[model samples]
Target: MTIAPRDLLRRMFDAAIAAAQPARCVPACLPEPPKGRLVVIGAGKASGAMARAVEDHWPGALSGLVVTRYGYKVPCERIEIMEAAHPVPDAAGLIAAKRIQKLVSDLTADDLVLCLISGGGSALLALPLDGVTLEDKQAVNRALLRSGATISEMNCVRRHLSAVKGGRLAAACAPAKVVTLLLSDVPGDNPMDIASGPTAADPTTCADALAILQRYAITVPRTVLEVLESGRGESVKPGDPRLAGCQTRMIATPQMALDAAAAVARAAGYPVHILSDRIEGEARDVGSVLAGIALQVAGRGQPFTAPCVLLSGGETTVTVRGSGRGGRNVEFLLSLGIALNGQPGIHAIAGDTDGVDGLEEIAGAHLGPDSLSRAWELGVKPKDRLADNDGHGFFETLGDSVVTGPTLTNVNDFRAILIER
Candidate 1:
């Protein structure tokens, strides 16, 4: 029953992703058929899949629309699956956002609005507030992506700028009981943070968003600043009557995914330790810290000992300064590989559960004792690539990049370090 380190790591990663798939997690969370119409509306990388899951499980007729990243769409017979730009939203997303907002409006209390929310909804559900154009939001989104701001910070700013986010969408569905099913990809799994909480009441205010923008040095258009400063951009706060009928259910989460991965590792005869499912901070710094732990377990056996796998799940930020392909997971793996220094019997894999990291189609990469040696042999300077934030390029050249296409699920980043004695 001995398993190769690389295959074992991949299995654990796959298990983590499969555990969070909408088809498996969404049905139980689905609310009973509404007295009136059942309208499904959502936006995220996994929204398309979530819609399909709802279509398959519901007994009565349901119709709706959902927006997903360009390549993340899943076919649905009843619900319309729309494709849009992500990370930096485009005109398509703006149009879709307006349409989604309209769809949820004008509903009665007897009607049910089933909102499917997951990661990436903030950008996919882009509908800039009045006085702020889509281009303005795009510029701010691009800057925020490169600013090394945590997801929460970026989302806080987004909530203030968007017309649909920060519980505005839920407010639009006023009088209709809004039931939201979420697949959490953020660090804390806060419903308000997922997809900027389009269907959940936001406790954050315009002041909080403005402070995040100032802290990150992210420049917004004058109109955006005016909205925030004038308090016009404030979100629907808690206890708002518009959101009184709203309810949220976390269908899948990072901790659940991590626990599933741990089960696979344990059944394969390796003890597993999940450090944290909410770890955050800079990608490289997290990698370095994990490397230190792996080294300790591999050498001194002080913590969990060797012949075990360490698992963790959480999103990490990368301050993109280099003009190279960058994904937080790949950056993490590259940094982890370098810090390991080709230590024997230490292997790791890091990938985004949704199968895309940053802007790259690649999920993430793998690291072994010879990852550095292989890069050096291929004339690739690991340190230089790391500095340039070119982890995708570094691993792609070595044919070690993990590509899973669109996994149709996101529980954030998954990292596994295997220490074999």
Candidate 2:
């Protein structure tokens, strides 16, 4: 059965996402119900789905609030699903964060706090620290997003600036055994970086956040700067007693997603090459690097021969200088397309596993040997769009943009390169 390159690429992406779905991965890791009460609290793009997974399997009386990015909600009868803005915090998220703080407080040792955390929770669970207003957090968040900072660096700043992140949420539920079920989107699967470690201990300090801001030249409000300098925003450390007995389990992660995609490619009779699931650095730079590899395999057959699929998963950043539709996945694909220079027998797809790239609903885009020709026919110049950081527009005009509303799970970005011999 011969398969088209584009079809095979889409199937690989679907396999990766399907491997991380909450219903399939969350149930087995759930702990037995506590003796007192099960307070289900969570925040992230996947928290709503994770909550619903709990509701489906757990027979205990569970109730709590979970905040997810708008349009990422999953229906649940017992747990309340709250919607909030992501990548930036809004007033709705602020109110929800306060309510979550109240809900988890005053719990006894026998009670259990089932915390569902995933990517995007850092912004969705936005509760600015005292003296740092929501506007202040917003300013810093906006700057961080545009500053080309790595996810860990951006999250370090977010952790110190928030009231609920960096273990404060777990601290609020002190005496109640906290169990965090995570779907990791961050590279390395560090629990502390996932959702800024809301229910886990943080080792990063205010000084580290300050350094990240300095490294990226991201200037925040004066008050936020002062708070970081004073070390008042220091997050809960590893030895903090409040986090005692807290258990964290990574139910799904980027590596697992990549493996699933590899399985699909292998079954389709294509030898799979997994470069890495933790690749980072600038998106455009990574794209250039991958293009070199694809070319090598196609021309020289150096590392591997033809008729193979190279798969990878990880979050990549973009230093946005142009005022265009900037998405990391799109930007990466655009750069990849240009670098390949319409090299035949090579096709690729790049998309965020969560189904939203940057602030746009478009997942990502696909690139073929004729991608440049199609764009030129559509009056979309590859270099011009790349200069404007408008990869989304470039792909859209070519009718090659991949759109999957919301996957309800985030294991970060997925990239695949198929080289036909």
Candidate 3:
């Protein structure tokens, strides 16, 4: 075989990235040329790249605004791309989100509101719900990050407490037909989970959002809690008439990317197995579970024959008991490597599809037999690093960090486990 293990891994990663290319994913999903004005608005790490693709493909005159993470900006004409805080919202996000809402306020029924949404959108598109202060929202968001809630559940809370989430944005375009092209970073590709369903209906209720908050013990200002309890700022429901004309399409997803990677693996004569596209929960715990499965396959070959790859994708959370500087992917890899205990003939990779793991530039990390021994030789303790909540620093020092810059799209987490015969 011409493919080395690492080479095959690189090839698969490349395929995954190719599957999520904004230029291709965005253009292919473009709706037919609408007769009316085409106003482009979006938010996410990939929003800038998606906007540029829209500008290049759509023959209609397009103009609008979008917000993206600070370093994930791309060039676009007519549509303004604003940079903002990610994984957390700031004044920049607040301002840009407001601009987007204002831009659609007066749209006529004939106009087309093309919303380009992707991962990181929830933070980049932050516009607190009426009666809730931005500070209040920020505090709640920080709490959620530490609460170990899944992205969908966290978004459930955000959707009900936001001015633009849960179907409100689509409602804002009222009468104007809205078509959302989404590059899903959320698992399950549930339109409702993509950036909190800015252009889709929200099946969750204020009561649901409140339940999530209570489940995590995320305390909020008394006024904010009252608003949720009172349902004063509840999101638009699934059957709301305003969303009747709204249409959404998943232009990209974790499964699509994983399928692309699997294709590469198959071409190389390696057997492949995909567990799921929507696995959830704490990063380390999920890693342990995957490690257990890998061990079963490697030892007894019950799950698959030797020389096979196990793949899975989904978003995971970190409870943040430590002060680590890593995201869930890195944490997962760390815990997974430790669980495997440097076992021979097994290696793995875990990362976020957006080229970022956690809040760092590292896409994720790789594991091999020597990984654990090497850490020990260098005076690095896996448990210590994991406890500090700093997977990035640990992996960075070991030179095992997978940094791919910004792939400009997010389909959430990607994991690959390889076993040699």
- Model 2 vs truth, CA RMSD: 0.7
Give the residue spans of candidate 1 off by over 4 A: none
Compared with the true structure, model 2 gives a TM-score of 0.99
User: For residues 178-283, what per-residue lDDT tens digits would candidate 2 score against the true structure?
Assistant: 9999999998999989998888788889999999999988778999988899999999898899999799999999999999999989988999999999999899
lDDT of 2: 0.93
1-421: candidate 3 lDDT, tens digit per residue: 4777766776787688789988988877888767778888989989999999998988778899999999989988799999999887899999999999999999888889999999899999989877788888888888888888888899998998899998889999988999999998887788988888888887788899889988988888876788789997688888899999888888988999999999998888889999998898889899899999989988998878888999899888999887777599889988998899988988888888888887787798877788889989999998899888888887887888887888888888888888888
Off by over 4 Å in 2: none
Kindly state the number of residue pairs that clash in model 3. 5
Cα lDDT listed for each candidate: 0.92, 0.93, 0.87
Q: Model 2, poorest ten-residue lDDT window?
A: 373-382
lDDT of 1 by residue, 1-421 (tens): 7889999999999999999999999999999888899999999999999998998899999999999999888889999999999889999999899899889878999999999999999999999998999999999999999999999999998998889999999999989999999999999899989999898788888999899889988877889899999999999889999988988899999999999999999999999999999999999999999999999888899698888999998889999989887899999999999999999999999999999999999999889999999989989999999999999999999999999999999999999999998
Residue 82 displacement (Å), model 1 = 0.6
lDDT of residue 226 for candidate 3: 80
Error of 2 at 408 (Å): 0.9
TM-score of each: 0.99, 0.99, 0.97
lDDT, candidate 2, residue 135? 96
Q: Worst lDDT window (10 residues) for model 3?
A: 1-10
